[model samples]
Target chain A: MDNNTFHHALKIREDLCIGCSHCMNVCPTEAIRVKNGKSVLIAEKCIDCGECFRVCPVSAIIIDHDDFNRIFDYKYRVALIPSVFTGQFPDEISEKQIHSVMMELGFTHIYEVENGVEILVDAINKYAEQNPVQRPLISSFCPAVIRLIQVKFPSLVDNIIRVKPPLDISAGFIIREFAGSGIPAEEVGIFYVTPCAAKIAAIKDPVGESSSSISGVINMDFLFSKVLRQVKQKKSDTCAIPTSGELTARATCWSLTNGEASQLSGRCLAIDEIHNVIEFLEKIENEELNDIDYLELRACDESCAGGVLTTSNRFLTADRLRNRATNRDKAPVQKHPEGFRDISSEKQFLEDNISIDPIKPRSILMLDENMAEAMKKMDRVNRIMMLLPMVDCGICGAPSCQALAQDIVQNNAKIHQCIFIQKILEQKGEMSLEEGVSVMQDIWGFSKTNKYRDLKGI
Target chain B: MMHFEFPIEGGNFLKAGSASSQLKKILKQLNVDPRIIKRVVVAAYEAEVNVVAHAYRGIIMIDIDTSRICIQLVDEGPGIPDIGRAMQMGFSTASPEVREMGFGAGMGLPNIKSNSDELSITSEVGKGTTVKITNYLEQ
Candidate 1:
């Protein structure tokens, strides 16, 4: 019944969705139900993997970022870095130097997500020992994956290792680490530099997890560029600029292509491309992949590196990261604050949030009549979908043939929206060029987001 | 007047998660709260799905009353030989196909057990399986 509490991290513009069923099709939990005319993203089941936003070429999907000005109201500000970020920079930018950059960025202190990952790994490793020889343990690294499993594969909810994501785990530690710092948790703002929409959505809709400790999110695209510009303009190029071999890069790397999950033991496999991940998760539902010990699935290919709104290119950025991570000697060599206190209670820690709640399902699915009507609509969709190839050519805003079907039922779309279908018809002398142009304009609706668009108006 | 049953086939990847969704729908019509409904549906669905994934074939029985909701999943599929061990968190017999859909977390039984106010399982290896779950109202 809590499915009624479905809250979306991002809202879909019916005008922008283009009836593309990509989001619905790739959602891990099957939480997305295409009803009416547009995509109905079930917030209860959405893992916030940001897969939909990434898959949408129209740049229609977006995660709202926090205004840095809002932090000025706070007495103190801090930046939380994921451990995977340790691999994002050059050797000159040592860990301590990166901390200095926080000072450079008007933040009083900086915390590493790696510290959280280490502690979280310890907790999970402890849990694994108690339940060895059971089912292969799944990594809890991905909050989206964890929640996706929770709502969609509640049957396997127990299978989800009782651990939290690096960010949540780390943020909790920071609070605890700052307990006696003379700064109140409320007075101090700890902003996370997010790589993808999942973390932002996770902040809003946490699953198989605990309350978020993050105060707010700053997209790396926004934060990194400003920091880089500030550093460049400072004329402090040769000052060593407080080098950081940790964070900013390796943490980004950790989120790369399921690298962090590979660190865990079990029948594990990683899936990129939300659709593939969804299909894989479904198999897990049907009792397939039982022997595979660990599954490290990411909605985006190259995992977090392929995050929708990052400033870096997937291939080039990952290559640069590889260079940085190789030089770092791992933690222990990394520096820590001289005097820091944690501000969180053990009861409030992310690790303590593994308990599952059972309630009566208050799902407001299609009423009997609604279902019948939906079924009829679905049949029409099916017929149209069959006529179109499944390639999801994206000639239509919809990613695949099925999305066109969903759009058709919603009445917001038509079968003629598909260019491939039109092309097929044209070859068969069923469509004319003029008709194709009209369908093209109708399929991929134009957005005024020319500011965010690339050369091709993506 | 109000009953729903989905024929669950063993090893059917595409068919998996069907019963859970159906049961969820039925519970929804009962005017259950969204939070409670999600929990019940997810738990009941997990158990039902396990029947299809881990067991051979099974019947999922659910009864919703004014006081409480009860679900009994009886399967002809091979029963769990070690109920104690199987009950542990992260234990699973799911196949690769199930894992692909992210259902082989081995957390199924533990989730069902933890979520429900009352749960009982009786099974015999190679014989069959049965799982009973009761979620009392306001409990």
Candidate 2:
């Protein structure tokens, strides 16, 4: 099996899942179902937002980031680390110490994603000021949010800004510069140190573009222990990479919530958390926020700092980022490094290539294979729903009244399976309880009074 | 054709967009294209908000056939005094409180016109207003 589809970004380990339905209920996209005592993922319906991955109690959901061992295959490996990684450590360990630790981990070079973010911030500010789209241009930084819009609110597809994400921009720069460098093209590898599984999934299957230059993704949590070990070693070595001060304070702030909007000057709204993002996007869809210039939305609660894979407390990480930003006093340069300026600045971020076409909604009820038969099944579902109590009590093993009705129409469940429906059937004056029991036995293939209890073989 | 009717209580900000959300769900169950669902949702939501912001009470009636979905919002309220002015951008009769809450940016009707394939409005100044929006089911 191809690695990309082997288990998807969020994989459910059937042996560990307890079928509590917690993941199914909390999923934003409703992409999970409890069937036969296990949680099954509806692959096509899943946007891989990592909601289920975060809510799973038993750690049964595994992220499919690239194996760390893969780094050895290339002669030269460069790590593109998100700025949030700096805040994951103690403040005493300076930014310079972090890059040295990455270098010690077999990485030939460490390129902080913050640099790319600075250029992106500049690019966005210039684009929004010069060529504004329909009011409230939505930020396309979060891949999960982009996919959600694709599945849930495609009409707003035009609203998403067209710029490539910071990590991808960094990767694209590396790929563009590789030809001039003396190193063989095949020997160089680029890995993104990501805080969320959604980034890993996005690298493999991009929504806005045909492909990504990112070679692989490494979860921040996976590197937490490794970096800690290096910190304990306390070995110091001089590295060629520039420190956080080399980038703008605005770019480093991207690790914290509301960072993206802070870089722009306008009526920009920055919203975090999945639930709030949904509500805010609805307002945008209704044209209620037409006066606003930009909208920054993140899937994680506290933005990247609160990603599922990170071990550090989000609040502590955010405070650390603030402290670091204040300590760095250098101002950002208006011009970017050579070669990177043109690609990051000249391209229209909201152009045709980045605007994704709307996708069909997830199929919640496909009653039958044929359209006519499906219509008949829909009628059957409605009839069954009328007979149901419509309370959405999950006692019948379905999430809602509509789900139970759908199950009945599809022949996967019987109306008598509902306790209320069974009581109604038994209430008929002519039929005795025994007759009702017999009828239930015929339909359900189970005897109310078990003969096994009376066995005398012993 | 199928019909769905939902009552809308004016001044109920808590439940203002429920009807349109329900409409989106129903369209999804019927396997309507997501693009059409979005267009219908935007138009329906604008009409729903108009009813909530300016009317005493209203009813959202959705009629869906094989090829089209029609949303008719009829409300008992102080209707629009000038239809031409209402159709233009940045023209609203909403109260200051509604504007403060971000509901009246004067983009509702114009947004509906942009999202829908066909739209019609009929109003009696002191009696009521009816906004009919139609969107093609297929792309």
Candidate 3:
């Protein structure tokens, strides 16, 4: 793969795949196609939204993450967890208990990912104010949504606020804090417990920015089980685990829907789910929507709470986080322990480094780089569409009829791949039965095509 | 060149911008510059909405080639009595219902003019109106 290509954290287990088109049918970007008894992912078109992972019936789709033992390599193992991780637990599990359990599980320190939100809120508003021309500045909070814009809605790339998200901001702060304490950066490892594959991709192949501050990624579900198992086994103990600063009510719910939009001072709108975001962005691209200052878009329906790696129900996790925020607002602030350090002290450092380089648009819609060639290809695609059936049966392994047409134009697929065209060719003696079976075998594997005996009853 | 046509039902705010949306998809597939696509779509959408807000019915005709895209929206309804005044910003004769739906901002013509490379309007009072917008592919 080229270095410039997007790094996807979602992977398909070829050994376990049944060539089921479920993932292909539900993919928001149509990045998956079935071939040779397995679903193949088009890396360039995939945004790592994990929609395919959600729809995969056989659990063939898996998210790649850093090994849990990798954290032990460094002297200081810091687990940067989002609020949703704790939201997976019942209310009886206190935040301190969660932190203590994580500390027992080989982490030297525990930090809330939303701690960066305090610095980020001000930077986002300032960015929106500074760039008045880019109306309805889209949030860079969701990595999946950022990739969605890069691939699908390329024109709106400029409208995305050029700022690091809370994950990176918190990582930057923690790295600085470690440095201030005379701890070498190499000795400190900050691993983000991510709730989605998109975050893992973002950390591995950062957009706009040259590199990510976080060292490694640990999937939320993996860590949630580890922490929960320990919490259940051990009784509450007063173990003084070094922890980061507390999160405000606003910051606690910052990863939830409308969290950032509610803080920004303007006519802002919060939209979640990949399809809903795409629909709204289409209108925004067409200039149908106007006079909006900010837009908060998340790929998952309930924001981070609905991330693919989440173990709890999306609504319940969201409700729990909201309740936590409400309780935090009403409760009195408690004194910090001896090892607790306020992240606000590094606010100036974070704000100074908040702005990232401009994000470039990598449009996947075009057939070719050259305009003249693309126009020719599009004309050919349209002509091909006239011949193919419009039913979008997916027997051709493509998501829709239009997709197969484009694939044919691009030479990635054959015209006869369409079952409708195959039947016509067979009827006209233009193609042999053996040739048709071979094509089917090539797309669906020989087992599926040679299963005439299994279909006797049906 | 590729030619396409879509019929726009007037006074139907629900279906407004459908034509422009289709045109935008075609331009995207043709590898048009993002800036140019934005201009064409904005102008096309404005014209489409104008027909929906003021006309009884309209048909949008689009002609595209490697060099430029030309769009024509012809509608049959109350035509512009004074084209020059209508071209001015904040000048609208839209009904109260149209304004209520946020369609009659009086900036439609001006917006289309700014976004399109060439914009021409021909109308006969109480008969019909025709809007032609052309956008170049290259800067």
Candidate 4:
């Protein structure tokens, strides 16, 4: 009944989807509905968090991004590299070398999203100190988590820090550097080489902002091969690599869990992965985290390094990141005025508009669109639920006992669809399926003329 | 009107707050207002967690109508010795283990108090405790 205005970053190839309901069970938004043994995505409800993308056994979900050939559309292509990109490779290879590799891949300039993180972090620290409103101020870096708050935890929307993701800030930097210097914005294409599909969705249809400054998104999995090849091509070219001053390990470690929050001082709650994040959000909603100063919620296991698009194991990437940061000779951050000063002073954050249009409930329990009818069906469902054993074993095609109850009320299934109920009925052997259903209808006092009567035969 | 009841076992951290989650789900299915649902669920969760943390065994009864929701939690455990003092912030009687787990900062009753339209707690020191929380469906 609703049309989704936001761009969905992940698309499912319906032909490949097995309708196994794995994605449906795990979806935070309940965006996926399996009808007719095929997965159907309700676009309006989808946050494009890619939890479905990660869980799909058949890889039916594909992340939407610009093709590699799209880079040729602009005269000068600039790639915004996330800090997690550096941790994907060996610790010995510096981030500067990675920049050079991107240059080799025809990127004229490679700006670090970490630069944006540095500025954003400093700005957030200052903002928290200045405006002591609530207990735990939520971090807005992870687009998935932000949208999760919009969809599920609307009460905490005001708690989210009014800040843009690192990529948006980095794109702003690129626009300032090149656009004013007689370079048209169209001529300079700023692409994000991201480790997660959420970033792709963020660029296309950003939350809490009007339009993203970043031109396109290129998943890190796609660029890993090109970067790996370029790294091997000119292994000895040290001059092209930028200095350590430009690339600090502190900024680069944003890929790991709590990497950004560790830079900030105070009680910070960093939760990673969708399930863990959901759990923590429940606690936050419970007001159990009043003492916590900051809440960092990432939708990936080990943070962005464990993103669906990443090739390396998140644990390895995390270790590599720590080793790289510890071995660095320079200070954690440079004292240069250009980087921190611009970030801390100006504080480039978009206006907070996390209030997405209220989404309609994707209720699996609804038996009818009419309220009175739905309530009557709900009562019947509850009655049926009481009759069956509550084991949520999915042998009946429905996800759980509760789901089967809704199905029964909706006339999509019969009371005997539950294996436990079926087993009991089989053991009794006195009544046929139709008789059993009729008995149930009589016991529940449901009308014989109603839709539940149809399931009497089936 | 819809009524649901769920049992709660003390010290079962794993299953704590599940009843509240189920209640939230039911409210969503009924298409309750999002704001009202949040207020009711938060209050219910705090009451639910209190039972899990302090009570030996408890039963949560949720009664919903077109106009309001009433969550009544009755627990058989060590009842609060002093209800007046317990309402004060940061006065926690939780064990070291529960405190270490980042719970029992004595914010449970207060959280429920703030989120709900009406909250009443009645406890008998040696007997048990009963918490009744009610929230209107609309402002």
Candidate 5:
């Protein structure tokens, strides 16, 4: 609930962690550190990109979500599903069957999150037209990318489009519909079945906005398994649950890579994956890139299909979604069929509330808040950098020698934490051998340090 | 105050702007305003590319303090005969080869002038050029 620090849904369980340093090595922001045989996350530096979750070998990383029974608390339970969720299943499974299975599992209504995309496409173009100087308007679709910009590319914060993403717009539309039908807001609960940890964190602690209308978050893998189980056990398909209106081809593929970029008219480019995004952003920040009008950046490869909580292979999911979109484009549109709700009727209302407040930069790069003090600390860091071996061994509980130097100047770590420094001090008769072993024990945990067996035993 | 220098190799388009990138990192660590950092980096990048496109070899020296950042780019090459003409936009004496690689677009000096608070240039017609750029931290 503390908005000052980022709310990370990715939690590392110490009981299962072995301090293998895989997560530390893969983190794009260098937010992870090995301490006491466990990987610790620096919350302020994490953008919830799920890179650590993907690289964790011991399965110690877990994404937290709301309890399934929480949906029963409200009179009306509406599952806000994304297209990627449906793409997780085999091609034989129809979208109607998935909705029916969700209904059988106790959901009163099913709505596609991309229903808002019908309205967002126009909004994005309008936003770009109005802000002519803020070239290369960055999409706000990916929460991790938004947080990354705030933390790493603070100077480019103004380039992010202020319009709410499709998820929020869809949630707003559905909530308004329930209210319009005389259902009290408390009785209607909108639960978003999320594809990644970033979405959960965004719903729990949103940026540029105070709170989200989403009542709860359900991991995609959990719901995918539940629906798959029901589909397998079902004996008859005659439940006759009213299906939600089919999404347009554009809406169906809205969360995929190049989904938004292909729709926009300009010199737009879509870049997927966190590291690639960082690399491209550096060029943009340096003014090395020009004539770019828009950018669609996602934190995950293949976009939402490659979400950490997804069960199916990313390529297969994306392929299925692409096939589905192609089929939808070829099919004729049905006009107000049985139980089909037209979200387009609420487009005006969604457009009115599409804009969000300006996002402020929360840079974690500075050594100190005061420029004068930070300059002094930087000088000390440079001095320490010269003394420490730049081997980046990670034995010092920091990711690199530079990181340790910064930590030392910030008083979060000591200079002796570096093994190279410890040996130099010991040879000069400044510290004893017992002191050196204790330092290793403190960083790598007691058990790992105590078992200094000979390599010849094997 | 802190001082640092980075060497630049002329005609090495691949390594150009490395000094500006390093300077950008240092400014961010110093808690400089994001707008100010952008301007300082843009100016530095332009000066860096100028050295790569025109000079044979160069070095960038930077001095940072609480008040401002001053960057001096010195290059050994055929210096400009007319500093006034070089400062004008779209006035480049670069070869067609340099223009093909998207460098030596005469806007380099003009762009640097617009992005920095203060700018100066001194050149020995047959020897080299030294460009000094300063950006205020508080502004």
Candidate 6:
């Protein structure tokens, strides 16, 4: 019996697809069903996390995020730069160069996504040491993967590291740190210089509503090269970025080697590559392993530095980062920059991390039925799910065929979305064109008559 | 009470979650509270994926009763040798390839234990493994 879990609401554009199959390979849900040499996203099962958008080389997968021009609406613009940027350009290029370039790009000031990382690192370290019963604390940095776990791997949802992601942790800081000053938090716009589409999606549609201090996205791809040109002329500071530089080096740049997350012990389990993380997640989902005390997962295999937008060779940049980190002065900087390194406002940023309503997903009233009928329908749904392929292509506008089948089971959709149904009708060679058109009208809820004759496209 | 059995394909990672999906729909239509519904769904799905990824072949049987839901996954594959080791948090035998998909973080069994009202398992190295998990109705 086929009783596939489906991911709904993920889609792929056939017109735009290059058939690279990267989406097929990378899909954590395996919901993309390839038919007629193109991909379809089974809608029922897709988590709508947008992993496909990042890996698509031809820019085939699409999402609905706004452009960089949106920054103009804000009076005070601050950039929350992802640490992955340090690994993007050649290592010799100083952090000051990177920061100054962003400063040139309409951002009034910049804060390290690294500092947010420090907050997360400390939070996870403290939480893990204290709550020894929680097993391995799964890193919360990968939003797409985390969302997949929420919808598909609910049991593992609680297993997700409780600390806020570096991005959100930093956002919390941005709010109180800046707000503590005379500037109102609402008036100050925080923009994330993003490395991935997942982060952009996360900022817009947040997980756990941790109040992503980020207001909007300025994609690194659109702004990086322009920022680089500005950086080339900026002078390096020997003493200006000392404390920030020491902490922001190497391990801060990208996915650490094994035992990197738990620097306390090299024995900690480390896995990079988002796809790989999903596999481990499934293992955890299937009751295969749970003894791990720490699981360090990097969405990008080489870590965020391998982000598609970056310019430098990933290997070289990682190497240079390593060199710089090791060379860092063991001696403390004369003093942590008192002015910019603001902590007085941190008191306000320390807000409740726990969700007020953990059980809200079950609060919906629509999911109930009688015993006998429910069993019968369960059997029927399993039988119907088998005819569809397991690939989770978004072509059907569902994340996978299994998800489409879920919609069918829920009465939200029908089996006709499978594309094979139309093929079967064509294969039968028994119906007239008029009969087919009428069938389409009956099932598709549309007719030859225009719904809006005055519409511009029509 | 009638029992419905699904023949879960072994080593078929893609189709693993199907059984759980069917169970979830049934529970949902029965108007099960989203809380209880989720518990049953997660338990059933974890066992299903285990059958597909690790077993040679298996049958996922779902038995419904008044007070709780019971799922029995009986498999013919080489069963886990050290249940204790297998139950260890973050201990996974899934290959690097499997690791790529985020399925083998070794959190599955512990997570299942955490989600269910009761969990029991019996297995022999050469024979196979059967896991019985029950989720109480009121939870």
DockQ comparison, 4 vs 5, better candidate: 5
True contacts kept of 5: 0.93
Tens-digit lDDT track of model 4 for A1-458: 11346677789897787667787777776566555456667675677677788889999999878998888899978777776787788767766667667766777666667766666666677768875976688887888887777767766777787766667766776676665477888898888888887788777876666677787889898898778877877774533444222546667687579887787878887889888998888777756556789988899899888988888888998888777777764545344332223432333432231123322233333345554565677788788889978886654555567767876776766676565776687789955766655544432233432565565443
The local distance difference test score of model 4 is 0.74
State the iRMSD of every prediction, in order shown: 8.4, 4.0, 1.1, 3.5, 0.5, 5.3
Over the stretch B3-33, how does candidate 6's per-residue lDDT look in tens digits?
A: 6688898888778787776676456555565
What DockQ does each prediction reach against the true complex?
A: 0.08, 0.32, 0.80, 0.29, 0.92, 0.24
Residue-by-residue lDDT tens digits, candidate 3, A140-161: 9999999999988888999999
Over the stretch A78-140, how does candidate 1's per-residue lDDT look in tens digits?
687654343344445444544555576677666655545444555666677787764656666
TM-score against truth, every candidate: 0.58, 0.82, 0.97, 0.78, 0.97, 0.66
Clashing residue pairs in all predictions, respectively, total: 95, 1, 0, 0, 0, 77
Candidate 4 chain A — worst ten consecutive residues by lDDT sum? Answer: A350-359
Instruction: Rank by DockQ, highest first.
Output: 5, 3, 2, 4, 6, 1
Between prediction 1 and prediction 3, which has the larger TM-score? 3
What is candidate 5's lDDT per residue for A1-458, written digit by digit as tens?
A: 56577799999999999888889988888899888788899999998999999989889999999999999999999999999999999988877678788887888888889988999999999999889999889999999999999999999999999999999998998888888888899999999999999999999999878899999999999999999988888833544544566788899998999999999989999999998999999999999887899999999999999999999999999999999989878874454344435778888888999999898898889989999999899989999999999999899999899999998998888899999999999999998877887888778887776455333242
Q: Candidate 3 chain A: worst 10 consecutive residues by lDDT?
A: A332-341
- Model 2: colliding residue pairs: A162-A349
Per-residue lDDT of candidate 2, residues A1-458 (tens digit):
23234225888997787666778778787666556567778675577778888878998888888899788888878788887887788877766677777777888766667766755776677667766656788887887787777666656676777677777766666655564466566787888888887787788877656667788889898897788778778866555344222555677788568898887878888899888998898777655545789989999989999988888899889887776677665543333232233334423442222233332222443444344455566667777889899886654555677777886776756676676786776686545566655544443234323453245232
Regions of candidate 5 where Cα sits further than 4 Å from its true position: A1-3, A235-242, A333-340, A453-458
- Which pairs in model 5 have colliding backbones? none
Alpha-carbon deviation at B18 in model 3, angstroms: 1.0
lDDT of each: 0.62, 0.74, 0.90, 0.74, 0.90, 0.62
**How far out, in Å, is residue A310 in model 2?**
0.5
Candidate 2 off by > 4 Å: A1-7, A125-133, A233-245, A330-399, A403-458, B31-35, B78-126
Error of 2 at A276 (Å): 1.0
* Docking quality class, candidate 1: incorrect
Displacement of the residue A342 alpha carbon in candidate 4, Å: 8.2
- Candidate 1 scores an iRMS of 8.4
